[model samples]
Target: MYSFTGNGNPTLVGQLSLAAGGIGLNVSQDGKYVCVGGVASANLYVYSINYINTTATQALSNSIVFGNSALGSNYDLNVRGLSGAQIEIDGLVNYDNVN
Candidate 1:
């Protein structure tokens, strides 16, 4: 992820190893946190942002895994709240067997 200042200079805030598939990203209303969803890995990651001296730093705060089931080809993530305390994730899953 990157952060842009008023002068339009971009700075590397953080980075994560995402799966080889489409990924979803959302930022909190307060810009204090961000959530990312990995479609291929079926996992979610939350990061906290700290700013100092016009530089931003991101730290992994939490992670949630949704088993190995193959999530569909698309995913969407939405975060809302005063401090981004609420998160809603939706996605399509592919199921090959049912018994």
Candidate 2:
């Protein structure tokens, strides 16, 4: 839960926890829309941006890792759309519409 306001350094805003065995992360274009998914399970997390670093900002968005609980060693973690790329599944288009 850290953020940087364009010029200044990063700061902690909040803290979130994943329910173990989480998998996917989808970020929208405007630093918003952070979605975390659970591995082989049915769960998702949505977060909002507090701040971002100008140089090393990726860590602010990529820190969403798998949790510890029923994780069982099978967490297929993956991140997508943080760069505003569109995803398609079975000819269906998916977009990060986070604001």
> Which model scores highest in TM-score?
1
TM-scores of the candidates in the order shown: 0.32, 0.29
- Model 1 regions more than 4 Å off: 1-21, 53-99
TM-score of 2: 0.29
Which candidate should be chosen as best, given lDDT against the real structure? 1
Residue lDDT tens for model 1, 1-99: 556567877666545555569676766655655768887878887665443232335522333322222334333222334464564645332222221
Count of backbone collisions within predicted model 2: 6
lDDT of 2 at 33: 45
Stretch of 10 with least lDDT, candidate 2 = 90-99
Provide the overall lDDT of each model, using Cα atoms, as 2-decimal numbers: 0.50, 0.47
Task: Please give the TM-score that candidate 1 achieves against the real structure.
Answer: 0.32
Off by over 4 Å in 2: 1-22, 52-99
RMSD of each: 16.4, 13.8
Residue 66 lDDT (model 1): 26
